[model samples]
Target chain A: MHPLDEALQMQQQDPGLYTAATHPGYANAVGPFGGITAAQLLQAALLHPQRLGEPISQTVHFAAPVNEGEFVINAQPVRTNRSTQHWLIQASQDGHMVAMATAVFAKRRDTWSGVDATFPHNLPDPQSVAPMQWQKRPEFTNRYDLRYFDGVIPHELSGQERPHGQSSLWVRDEPPRPLDFAALASICDVFFPRIMIRRQRWVMIGTITLTSYFHADSALLTQVGSDYVLGVARAQVYRDGYFDQSAEVWSAKGDLLATTHQMVYFKD
Target chain B: MHPLDEALQMQQQDPGLYTAATHPGYANAVGPFGGITAAQLLQAALLHPQRLGEPISQTVHFAAPVNEGEFVINAQPVRTNRSTQHWLIQASQDGHMVAMATAVFAKRRDTWSGVDATFPHNLPDPQSVAPMQWQKRPEFTNRYDLRYFDGVIPHELSGQERPHGQSSLWVRDEPPRPLDFAALASICDVFFPRIMIRRQRWVMIGTITLTSYFHADSALLTQVGSDYVLGVARAQVYRDGYFDQSAEVWSAKGDLLATTHQMVYFKD
Candidate 1:
């Protein structure tokens, strides 16, 4: 069966509710790079996007180790405001809250103003895309659809491009997952700092706490859209063996649809 | 009076750990940059340069607030090994531990192998030499030598700059004061993220938590030195009027001296 088909089967078994997903790569040890990377848990619960493309945001708090087992995730839309919707998500195992997140979502509409910019100009020309650590072993995990927006591979191994200043990329459910607006909240983790840091090696996960803000006016891509928005992120704190990354993404038209932040393990 | 001379006199007047000279900008609030900047704290704590000069690799948590006032910062080198050194620094206000930092210092050494070439070119070109932040803010807190290694001009009105990526700048006592390690620890706040974010606009203020790490083999510079090492900082989270920042500084030789991570009220 097609991998996308498998995703559909899983969702059919248990729609996009408080579901459980396994850890990916080095994230398995430190508990999903600080428990429930924005990608793994945000879509767990949502009010079901009112429209095909609604804006969303999310946050997660790590309660404990999720270890190698099937944990539970609960996501619910907390408040739907005129401009945005708020969500609260929790990941648990054995009936205990393993991790929790609070997020915001906005409706997608047509408007424009403020910052006008495209992806950073000085970046490596997209002609040099290559497979990276996490993306390299696509056979390992079925949960990730980590693709670059303009075919911009954030790999340091190729020995060419480095995370100069800021970056952006596209990410989606590996088809058939029926991801909702809430999932878009967590899906914010696609092209980020930590992943690009070890562009050459493995995706060094160091995200601990994640908070995301979304704009409802942004159009949603019902069918894993290829349009990627750009955002600015930085590794704010790198202490001991961990580091934190934060960013705000603007739609292709520069509407601040969502802002995402996280803590990732940084051990070389 | 020569800035250095005035600072020396102040040190004599109130001989306490973590004492820094006054700047016009810092004068209005507390030390400098309203409260204090990490650059001043680290620069004042330059007496033991060999111990404090390594670049900060990461910050664990920046727990409390160190406001502007006359106080003492007491720091002790916690653990120093060939690879890392740990320290315990405390900011006491009226005899209470108002701020505390547990830092880990790392040594950025050179070997025939590994990936130094990756980060070198990306390290902000210090020579593109824009007038130091202090230079632009001639009317503001003009008491330090704040060179934005990767500078930002926070809205132009305040002569503050917010670099896109990690902020790297050379900070030193302008009215150069005679400071030790403990005193320098308290001063890290001056260049912190919350303060940096204020450059964007006003938000609500919330409680912030911060942590720091010191590596082994660090060479502290708690005294007046020739060339300065740069302090690198970034913000991890900023939302709900609350945000956290992570940062560290390296000596001119690239030794990881101290690192800091803090969360503070994002008062709008």
Candidate 2:
């Protein structure tokens, strides 16, 4: 199994109870990368027997630092409607909660479809853009092939003031894995905190909460294959040591695949 | 007290257990307004003794239709850090969950603060604009003083094929209450569904998941007082009978008060 798959793999200890081992490959400054934990929480819902369909929306709260070891995830289908299902998933280590999330899934049907927001234009091909050099950064950064299109890359920010906290880039799984909902969830957090980009300073920061809206279906994700997807993220406001970042993930053909928003807590 | 306040008012029967009455003025087509429910859920957290600071982020899942009448709310402080707290709140009728929500609160500290996203430019003042006619809409609409700057008002779609799902308006509480977190939470859902604006068809639509990030603190909110705040909402994509809407609430002075995103289930 791919390392990410292995990290996300869960054993069904009992119905609605699963256990997962933390993988060191995706380690951040703290515990495991938040992205992987998010994907794992969503995975629990996806693996549920009562799951209705694909995930429509998910919000994950990083309540505490997850320790590196075996963790238990309990996913409960809180409510199941004819067309949609709501799930509550929590990750606990040593009998203490570390993360909690809620997911909404629905069996989508054909309907009037359109993209209102235009895909960002004029981006260099992923092949032409060079991958970010990661030597002393978080181990998780090595798991993704990232090509920056604009904005200050992490660790490269000098005390420069940027007009806005915006970053556009092309990113995909480093080992070139096929695109899927789990991978998409991970990609949403790939954008380094907007504060790090804007102030050109790498401060202690963590995402307090994240919400992702999946706009692509399985077919669309499959069609994209292992190609890179363009991502654009910008901060609306940075105040009181917290900022809100909004992002969009688009297919190579400019199809909007997902949009995510999060609030980050930073120590200045 | 205003009907909204009455509707949201909860009596603490016991620690973490509260009882609330549903006010008819906030009724939607089927149940109490989702916004009101969201506010009440947050209110529960606010009233919690262990609650810290203000709400930084909140996501509420409408699991089932909330029937009118008395309801019970249970709020729990899931995790509390030195500066931040995580809460899980649920609303039930007769012991069955109707809505579930997670909220993050933090004692904000002064830091480098700025608004990256400019307040939308060239908008008419709220006074110059006329309030939307709500004679035949949801009873909740009557609670807001709304002035549309663009997009087709709900129920007034004239079958025009607009390029995108976008709406810009100035809104305030109907009784002209001072801005607060709960009131701001309610205002976040004031915009009609983007599909209704883009296709000019009033389809059966409901918000399944809604997440709001508060950018302004109580001081800023109080400073804005009862003045109208500009709201802009747009959809990135609408497909498979579901669409996602992103919106921003900005003070007339251009301070971004809140940003919200939601996934809505709709019938074409």
Candidate 3:
């Protein structure tokens, strides 16, 4: 199996309870990559026996860093309507809280369609852009292929130009696995901290909370396959040691797949 | 006392539980206004004894319609750090879940500040714009004074122009109440459903999940006491019985106060 798949492996001990171990390949400085953790939490619901349908919206809050070891997940479907469902999930290690999340899933139906937000246009294709090559990066960075159009990490920039904290890039898994909701959720957090772009330097930063809204369904994901998805992210405000990052993920065919927003805690 | 205040009144039943009733003044088609319900969910945390700081991000998922009676809210601060806290809340009537939410709060500190979002400019002041008056609207509509610069409800429009589902307006309490986190949160949902602007007609639409990120502190709220806040909202995509609405609420002083995003279910 691929490393990403191994990283997300879960063993159901009983209903609403599962045990999983952290993969060193996906480990961050403190624990596993937030995206994978988020994906793992999401998987709890997706793998639930009573789950209603595909996830429409999900919010994950990181209370503390996860310790490198086996963690337990308690995911419960609090309510199930005829057409929608609500869930709550938590990750804990040694009986201590690490992260919690809430998710909404719904059965989709045919309806009138429209698109109001403008898609990023006139960008170079993924094949034309060179993938980022970095040394001394987090282990998780090596699990994905990232080709940037702008907003490269501050350490890689060698100039006096100050960016406005915006990045547009094409991203996908390193081994090229098929696209799924879990993969999409993980991809949403691929942007480097916006502070790195604005201040032209790195700082102590961690995502306190992240939310992603899914716009595509199973059919759409199947069409996306193993292709790269374009991701665009920008910071809106950095005040009082907290900043907000908003991002949009688009398929290679120019379809909006998901939109995500996150708030990060930073030390200047 | 104001109806909104009365609607938000919570009686502590225990450490992590409270009881509140739906207010007729803020009634929607079946239940109370979504904004008021969201505010009430947030108040459960703000009123909690263990809450550490102001809310930085919150997500509310509507599992079912809340009935017009007293409902129970179970809010618990699952984890608390030195400067941050995580919360989980559930609102139910007669032991059935109606809504659930999660929130992140942080005690802030001074840091490097920057704003990358552009506030809407060249707009008429609140004093110059006429307030909207409607006779057959939901009761919640009367609780606020709304002056639309554009993107008025389709029922009020009398032209052949097609809108891209966007609205820019000034909004405040009907009797002018002091600004706070709850009021700001309620205002985040003040924009009418984007479907009304996109299809140029009213449809059966309801928000399924709403997430709001607060950027203002108590000091900023105090500075804009009882003043109108500019609210701008737009739809990104409406497809397969669901659409996403993104909004930014700004102080009259051109400061971005909060940004909210929601996914709504609609029938065309």
* Best of the candidates, DockQ: 2
Model 3 Cα lDDT, one tens digit per residue, A1-268 = 9887887789999887999888898888778899999889998888888889899888999989898889999999988888888889999999989999988899999987878878887989889988875434898988999998787763465534364889889999998999999999898888888887777776789999999999999899999999999999999888898999999999988789999999999998
User: Candidate 1, after superposition: displacement of residue A118 in Å?
Assistant: 5.0
What tens digits encode model 1's per-residue C-alpha lDDT throughout B110-183? 32111211122355544455635422342324555566755454433452434332566766555555433432
Model 3, residue A183: what's the lDDT? 90
Which DockQ value does candidate 3 get? 0.82
Model 3 alpha-carbon drift over 4 Å, by segment? A134-136, A154-163, B154-163
lDDT of 2 at A225: 89
- Residue range with the least summed lDDT across 10 consecutive positions in model 2 chain A: A152-161
Off by over 4 Å in 1: A1-64, A68-113, A116-141, A149-168, A176-185, A192-199, A202-248, A256-268, B1-143, B147-169, B174-217, B220-268
True contacts kept of 3: 0.87
| Candidate 1, chain A: TM-score against the reference | 0.59
Model 2 ranges with Cα > 4 A deviation: B154-156
The per-model lDDT (C-alpha) reads: 0.43, 0.88, 0.88
Candidate 1's TM-score reads: 0.46
Ranking by TM-score: 2, 3, 1
Candidate 3 global TM-score: 0.97
The DockQ values of the predictions, listed in order, are: 0.04, 0.91, 0.82
- Candidate that scores best on TM-score: 2
